[model samples]
Target chain A: MSQFAPPVVKIEGITKVFGQGETAVHALRGVSLEIEQGEFVAIMGASGSGKTTLMNILGCLDIPTEGDYWIRNLNVADLDEEQLSVVRSQLIGFVFQSFNLIPRTSAAQNVELPLAYQGVSLSERRKRALAALESVGLGDRGRHEPQELSGGQQQRVAIARALVTNPAMVLADEPTGALDTQSTKEILELLHKINAMGSTVIVITHEEEVARAARRMIRLRDGQVVEDTKWVA
Target chain B: MGGLGLREVWRFAARGITANRMRSSLTVLGVLIGVSSVIVLTAVGNGSALAVKQGIEKLGTNSILVMSSGGAGRFSRSSNSNAKGLTIADAKALNDPATAPDVKMAAPILNASGTCTYGNLSSTPQNITGTWASYFEASNSPIDKGYYWSNDDVVAGRPVVIIGTTVATDLFGTDSPLNEVIRCKGQSVTVVGVMKSKGSTGGFQDADSIVIAPITFVQRSMSGYGSLSQIQVEATNASTTTAAMDEVTTIMSAQHKIKAGANADYRVLNQASILASSTTSSHTLTVLLAAIAAISLLVGGIGITNIMLVSVTERTREIGIRKAIGAPKSAILTQFLIEAMLLSLMGGISGVALGVGISHFTVLGVKPVVSLTSVLLAFIVSALVGLIFGGWPANRAASLRPIEALRYE
Candidate 1:
């Protein structure tokens, strides 16, 4: 939104190696990136391109092995597991491709989970959860469990859950990977509307159509960024 | 750390348990069996112990019995050719205050069993004890109806008798037996007093099926005055019973010319010693029953652990989802731990109720006495079992990594 504001995410040359010795696999090799606030960006990569690893680090679910990662000026590497949990609850939201809603729980309750981890009171959590569901165009489906809902409806519930915390960024890992073409279009349009509301959005995907919906595109090849471009649609 | 309050955690735990109703109920049943058995078995042991105590106490706590070792024991009469029999003279010596200071009174009893008849009714009494009036006081048999025969009755060889409740009910029916003449062993005797009902003792010996008469009359009419059967000695008080026994034994051994520590012709039965030995045996039985029940409780605890482990494994994906949504480790831990605790605590409470209810009825002819200590102990132990057994699975659930959990199928 502004050129003067510092980037919401900044990472130095970061490397992530899984295991040790000669058997160790390098998932991320000295990659550097910055993502600004209010930017709807898509990170495109094939399987094993280190995109998922980078998303994990940015979401504070993990820390870099050899470099520093800062989320809103807080050094992620310096924070412990408990502080990382707080950051995830208060600052970041995640939407998985599988719509990982807890079984036997209502959609409204699922949306309220992040706020619950943030220690929100029950009444306040309910109000915010209802508002989030309303924004996701499923206000009346709040009480339905995931099993009772369609795949698209479950994904919408997950999206509502991601947005309920008013996080700094919403990281969707192939949000429409399991959806039909019609559901994908609807989900892409919802992401557009969410981005227009001045919230930063990141969609990680291997699909060209999904990446095409974002204003900015970053492509990864072999654990390193190969292309970065801005598209005016 | 502070997000999930105790109440919220409890609700979550309750929901988790209800989600798998069949499994949870089975686990609860296991704990219920363990706790209830602990209470029931211990109560049975306590009941038998109390029954024994009551039986011995009816014999009078301050009394001691000096019987001839020539017989099978105190209850039976079998001649042993090598041993000398107890006599009336030995009873008189125990009654002397200067030689046996702790002795309050002494009565010599000659037991004879015979059919008693009044009018056309007849009944065989288990014991027809012929003794002086002092036997009534020493043996704790109180007179329920008429007055006891005087000392003059013994000197004059009077045919006066006292009948037990069972004998009175048998020979006289509802009619009062006071001043009525009854034939016992072909000797006519006047019923002077009827002893109070003592009920059946230890479910074996019938204390209310006996007849009592003056020793001189029984000797003249039935058994000849060769030797007395047993000497019933009453101490000054319960605390001096051991002293009275020691004094009687010493005097009898000297009178019989038996050396110290040698095999005497007689045996002394102290009620206090019998009480202590019986109490000790019953205590052992109680401990044994409790120990066996504890093993079942331990198995129930193991059942909890097994069920919790299965729950953790089954809910791995769910745990992953919660962790991804920013649930702290402690919250997950608390949720699972509380679920296990609720199961066991429910079982324990229900077990207590069931056990107490069962104890109200007689089992194996022993009336159970429910001890408060066993109830409290069983409950506390059950709760601890839940906490301790649930710990491993809860920790396993909590320490799971968010990324790995989310990726879990």
Candidate 2:
């Protein structure tokens, strides 16, 4: 990676408040962070530590109340809801804790969802979806629905979905929270392999073991960054 | 925003609907009932209207009738006190070419009910109308068998009669009644002609259960010859029927010494006016039936809205998944809207089939005539019902925030 390249994500004094007046709850209070390209980072926080809220902001699913947030040098605050959706489709990928695969849909179709939203032709989407499934070691299970697949296999399909668009970064919100220990190990290894291939990966977790798998760790306490540490290979 | 293609939108909607087969089918049945009722009820109304119009047209479009309003006692001159009854003089006046140029022919009539017998087979006709031979042309009664008696037979007061198909069937049982002598009102009358069948009108009056004879003979034997019962007039053409009616009215009013716009003792009725009034009434009935059916369609639309609302609630997480993956609001909206439209459209098509199929058979003694306009209108209205009622639920699904929707259990 070039040293002068711009960071993938940059946020300055980002605040998110719910409700108004005296009853308003401050979900995020003046948080500042930057994430460079090809970096593997883990954001750690306890429940109510605003990690989820921050993940939402970074994924462009939400807007900050009082801050300037940029994605690849583009100001996100100026974009409308439609543009934000486009940014989500083309620029970012999300992995939910519960492996949010659409019910009654095949694994290949689930992986092709983002491309479908981007208006890719049917033949091209099918080809790319099959390739993505193959990359996740489930090429033969392309036609299997989420209900038929195990937790680890479903998580692999989700990771394939997250990488199908070749997004700038992948944001995982407790991706291993709903899996067994063995499934969690497999998912963490998959994330590591994706990072080793020069793709940016961000993992959000409350577990110390999951944090240790990433090269860098940022801890949040009461909506503020309490610790930032980097581990050299 | 670039989003799912139209084909994909429709595919998603189809899948969504098929996911809940029971509820979707029930919703479709609701719309089906509404649309079918609209078609069937309107068909019945139109059928009855057509029956009435045919009845009026059978009396000859250019024919007019003048009848006395002086009550039933006009048959006996001594019982009638103040009101003057119509007489043969009024008929002669309307027949005069100099005074009533539009009148082609006018015949005075005397009506009586009598038991007719031929060789011990007796049948009582609904009415025995006594008039000139010109009555045959004015009333559109063609001869199915023998010939009609002429005006000379009327002047001579000959006992000559023409029987209708019903009376012929009852008396002869398929045999020809021509040149046979029948006893009518204790008088022997020779059967000269048999009129063609005109069928029953609106299932109330039998146009074929009638017998016609010379007016002079009827007055002399059956009625007392006090006053004429009715005068049947024929106009030169259909266009001159109103002029003919006016001329008959003017002559009758002058003969009865009735001033202009005063209460005349006689009433003039023309086929055109009866047809117009009947048509207007039937149109009103058709509209009323259609309006009643529309209410059911509206209820069906509400059923769609109710089901769609439930669907949105059930599929909140699915919508969130799609939205989080970058599905545009329009995609969500189109998906739900297409689902609703598919339901109503299927109902509309099947309803048309059911309604048209039912209309082929007679219902409640009335043959239903399906109007094309009603069918098209019903189908179009059903589609519109889906669009209008589906809008609210679709918007609700579309406007839901991704985070809140995903958070919903």
Candidate 3:
């Protein structure tokens, strides 16, 4: 991989230690990595592994204890909760494993979530929310709440929410973990389409099938990256 | 999106409230009861104050009366007892160039309670006051029939009297007592005039009363030969009346020859002055009640905080999803705040309705004039309670991290 390019994610000598004193656990130990913009990357690790921690750091959801992390030129490690929220709201859209839609909220409202944080006017928020849902082919079902939607439809709504802000990247953690095979395929295809749209996409999961869908893989064992590979799909 | 925040708050609170329907209702009920109580009690207090004010106004706020002080009007509240009784000397002093320049007029009153008779018809003892002609203007006493007797009656000691409405009813029915001869207190006095119905003035029926000959007749015949009882003095206007009072007090003291620190033998009193004192006391009581009512609103605010806390706990996943989709902590806080305000505003509205109802009933059972001030006070208080109480829990909701919230099962 070329190092001179504009990298979407850059980590230098990152170490994430959990707890304090002698009983502390080192979840990431001086790990360093870089991924360029528009790259579809996958992070894989078993239970107790720190792949999710690395994913969080790249997503600006967590700060590394003892290193520098840059996302689209902004330092993640130095950002406070407010700064992090700004980055999270405007730069990196997130889709969780369980299709974490707001319970009792309508699909359109869930999609409009990012715009609300952006201080969009009411009409603009509604218009953009509807457009985002329409892109996911769920326009007619905007009024349907989370529970009324299928697993696939719910994931689509989550994806719509992530895409609504036109973020620099989409950070998805186990995006298909709770879906059936059919819904899983649908979710993967949605991520694939979002990846093709020029935004960098990072998927964090332990599943091999999910990892294979990404263009590059960074595999972790325990707390260290053991394999970094690019697979032709 | 509406800054009203109520729409959003209600939308969200509906979820929390629905989860434990009975519990929420009970809590709302408690709050409602507290709110209504505040409104009701305040209305009652305000209503009573108004009645007292009206009664005082009827007695004339501008009139000054001098009554016999301690040890004089001792046995009878009606009699201007004590060594304090205003003498003809004070009445004469009212016109003195050295002292009472601002004194518009003064009525030297000699009050007598006695029966009046015409031929064979006898009436009960009525309130008979021997006063100057200026008594009509100062005390708002009106004449219904015949002209008042001239100053000749007082100067020459002519036997004549002015009769009140009650005396007219009891003695003459409706035949009119003007130009009639009546024996009063064992003296034959000709009726010269009849006083119009003054209705009730400070709980005393003034219409059914009579006025007799000057202080001389009342002292010698009516009150067992008592000295002059009281003097009513009127000032040109209510504004300069306080200064006029100072002048009167100084002159009277000079006449009575009392040193400083001695208990006054005579009491210079005014219904308007008494009313002002009563208003101060009533205002204190009102403020006290309003403070207690304000506390109930605080309790209502706390109730909102507690309920919102429970809501935050229950919807942990929702917060996670919102944050994941780029909803910031501020957004979350605003959402929760809106919900809280909405709940309280609704409760406030309900409470206002309840308050008005209670106030209305308060006046209905007994006449209480519920004014605009009381209603306005209740509204401002309730809304303030909502804002202050809802603030904390909403902030808490907004502070939750997306990751932590997501991790919540």
Q: Rate the local accuracy (lDDT) of all candidates.
A: 0.88, 0.88, 0.75
- CAPRI-wise, candidate 1 is medium
Top-DockQ candidate index = 2
Model 1: residues with Cα > 4 Å off, grouped in runs: A1-7, A12-30, A62-68, A73-78, A138-141, A193-198, A231-233, B67-86, B96-103, B113-126, B143-147, B165-194, B236-269
lDDT of 3 by residue, A1-233 (tens): 35566688888988899999998999998888888878899999998789888877777766778989887788776677777778888888888788888777789877876776777766788899898898888999999999999988998998999999998888999888888998888888888888887778899998889998999999888788888898676
Error of 2 at A33 (Å): 1.2
Task: Specify the CAPRI tier of model 2.
Answer: medium
Judge candidate 1 at residue A151 and give its lDDT: 93
lDDT of 3 by residue, B46-115 (tens): 7667766776665556678776674343233444333455577877787575687666777788767666
Model 3 pairs in collision: B9-B338, B9-B339, B72-B81, B72-B82, B73-B81, B73-B82, B164-B209, B165-B207, B166-B208, B219-B225
Clashing pairs in 2: none
lDDT of 2 by residue, A134-222 (tens): 88889999999999999999999999999998889999999999999999998999999889888899999999989999999999988
TM-score of B chain for each model?
Answer: 0.92, 0.95, 0.74
The candidate maximizing TM-score is 2
Model 1 C-alpha lDDT per residue in residues B67-103, reported as the tens digit of each score: 8877643333446565667778878888889999999
* Candidate 2 lDDT, B175-202, residue by residue in tens: 9999999998899999999998998766
Task: Tell me the tens digit of each residue's lDDT in model 1 across A81-105.
Answer: 7887888887888888999998878
Better of 2 and 3 by DockQ: 2
Q: Candidate 2 i-RMS (Å)?
A: 1.9
Better of 1 and 2 by DockQ: 2
Q: Residue B367, candidate 3: how far off, in angstroms?
A: 4.5
What ranking of all candidate models by lDDT puts the best one first? 2, 1, 3
